[model samples]
Target: MKVVRFICRILLGLVFIFSGFVKGIDPMGSAIKFGEYFSAFHLSFLGNFSLLFSVLLASAEFIIGIALLLGLRMKIASWAVFLFMSFFTLLTLILALTNPVSDCGCFGDAIKLTNWQTFLKNVILMVPVMVVFLERNKFSVRYKPLGEWVTLGILFTGILLVIRYCYFYLPIMDFLPYRTGTNIPKAMEIPEGAPQDEYKTILYYQKDGVTKEFTLENYPWQDSTWKWVDTKTVLIKKGYQPPIHDFRFTDQEGNDITDLVLYDTRYVFLLISPNVQKANTAGIMQAKSLADLCHGGNCAFYALTASPFSEIRNFTEKNNPGFPFYHADETTLQTMIRSNPGLMLIKDGTIIAKWSYREFPEVERLKNDILGYAVTYYREKRESLTKTILILTLLLTLAVIKILQLNFDRRD
Candidate 1:
């Protein structure tokens, strides 16, 4: 019985550690996963709080894991672990039943488990946690001074804040759909008579005497010397607009204009945001600075929001931000960028660049993107053809070589 309890403790501790570490690496991903749950329930209004909740939940898991591993406060730690596992089991079961999300993201992108799989995994974990809960009174260990708990609490609080700040700026780690996403054109209607398939081709580039391939699945993170290009090859079915679309909104003054389409003569920076009151004030100010830079460069700029005209006007007036505030649908703006204050760059109806409010590049970086040659529209098609040809050629060559070798052996 004692041996069984020891094994259960170790198992529970390891499970918590693995789960917490995976989530810690990408708290933002966890936050987005939580947001998916909230959105499915039509509680998307809670999206703004997802990040905060993610940090707290992740910290709790890490702290509990440490306490469990150290065998400190067995009674409290066991109860906490059991409760946490119980809640997790309920959440996973609910998710599996409703299928609200495709992946539970229990381990973030580090481990992709389907809802049912996660449900089963959690159900199994419940056993150990339950054992610990039942036998906690019998468990004993050297007790640490009360000061240790206080110190740990303070340390965890600081860690949470730092993690939140990092995610708010440059995400320490990206583990979701948008991690190093391909830079594809946005806002174009699909032309008639396009292919229909989910086929993706990788572009192989030769650099520094080595060949490297970049595919939609393994992109952005490549060898330092290798460059990756994502050919946005999509088969357009009937009624399929191009994956990209310009954001059009009405300004506070009631003027109808498209934020990204203006200034076909130069780059246009469209800052997609919720109303100032709805967004973080600091984020708004940072976006305002970027808008000011665009204004100085004779580049067209607009701050798009979904708020009422009067509210936007009053907010702008009070803040004295020198950019035009435009109104768009709340849902549409959110889809364009997950961050509250996001920026998109468009030229000739093509999305040239995009940045979360936290990652808004300096003026010089924006200039570099504008000056670079925009990706050609036909590049995706060309790359797809090239990949198919290369693969077929390799197969044919191998077949011929094998046939020749067989004939020679027969003749001998």
Candidate 2:
């Protein structure tokens, strides 16, 4: 019984911790998923609070996981876990049955799960949840109430800061297919002998004021009296799809210049904005400055957006960004970067680096060589993020050790 209780507590704690951290790191992505859920459930009015819900959910999961793992406030943490799992488990069941959204976004972009898969995962998790609930009172507190809450408050603040930084800048870790170093053209390729999509064609026919649906295997091909009403193709099975199937660039005149730009020899700067109307004005101006920096350099600059031509024309006329704006898919743009106006540098179809507007390279840094500066900046940023995570982990470890030491002293 002791062993079982320990195992259940650890298992549920780690699962919730990972789930919460991943979602917290990409709060915007989680918010986007929440908006999708709201729209699908015909509760679009709640979309305005998606971000709020996203932050709260991540915080709750993280706190609850820590409490369970450390045996801090087990009474409350166990109840929280039980109630949380119950609600989400039921919600996932409905989602699986209705099939309103394809992916449940349970782990944000870090892990993709179909609705049915998510439901099954929750169902499996419920076992440990039940055990933890039943044995909640068996665990002993290691610290005073004040100490436990102070630690939790610090953790909560730390998580919120991390989320805020990621929201203003970009995600510390990129999980999307369009991450830096991905070759756009190569990522969009389909392997030879890949299975094709299998669709069943259903033909509808009307005769004598009656309509009947038939498949090609049973259709009355020879009957001349049957009048064709409609044809419907249903996808029986999905096939292999490339990671970047929906990415394309269309010029003002509706010309596909994807190949031309992707195959270019020199570096190309692409400023991506999913919606021009809601984009930050300062970011737009910063992008304009970047365009000026690339004017006579070995790089060319362009802005790509999902906004309509009218918005683009109006924005261009007012801002005069000194670069062309092309049209792309809104969802693709959103998937590419979390920032509204983000900068991406690609050369020969390979994404060299990406930056949120807040982290955009200063004009002074790029005065000498744009590519050289960008490469150095990207390397430094990557190292910085890695170091920050390591420091946080070390601090948490030290804190836990100190707490354990204090508990031993008190016992002595």
What are the root-mean-square deviations of the candidates from the true structure over C-alphas?
22.9, 1.9
Candidate 1 regions off by >4 Å? 1-11, 21-55, 99-105, 108-114, 134-140, 143-151, 167-170, 185-270, 281-289, 295-339, 342-412
TM-score of each model, paired residue for residue: 0.54, 0.95
- Please tell me which predicted candidate would have the highest TM-score against the true structure: 2
Per-residue lDDT for 1-412 in model 2, tens only?
8899899999988988888888888898999999999999999999989999999998889888888787777889999999999999999999999999999998888889999999999999999999999888888776677767767777778888888888889888788999989999999999999988999999999999999999999888899999999999999998999989988889999999788779989888889999998888689788877788778766778788999999998988998777788999999999988888998889999998888988888878777777798889978887988999799979977776666556433321
Clashing pairs in 2: none
lDDT of 1 by residue, 1-412 (tens): 8998888888878777767766775676678778888999999899999977888777888778767775666888998998898888898888899988888877867788888999899888888888889999988644344533643464366456546654564344444332333233332435668653455566665567766676667755545666543344543333443544544677566677763455366777777776567676666777766677676765777788888877877877887766777788775676455566777776655455556676565665555555352333124434864786577568645653444344223221
| lDDT accuracy of residue 243 in candidate 1 | 45
Poorest 10 consecutive residues by lDDT, candidate 1: 178-187
Q: What is the lDDT of residue 334 in candidate 1?
A: 61
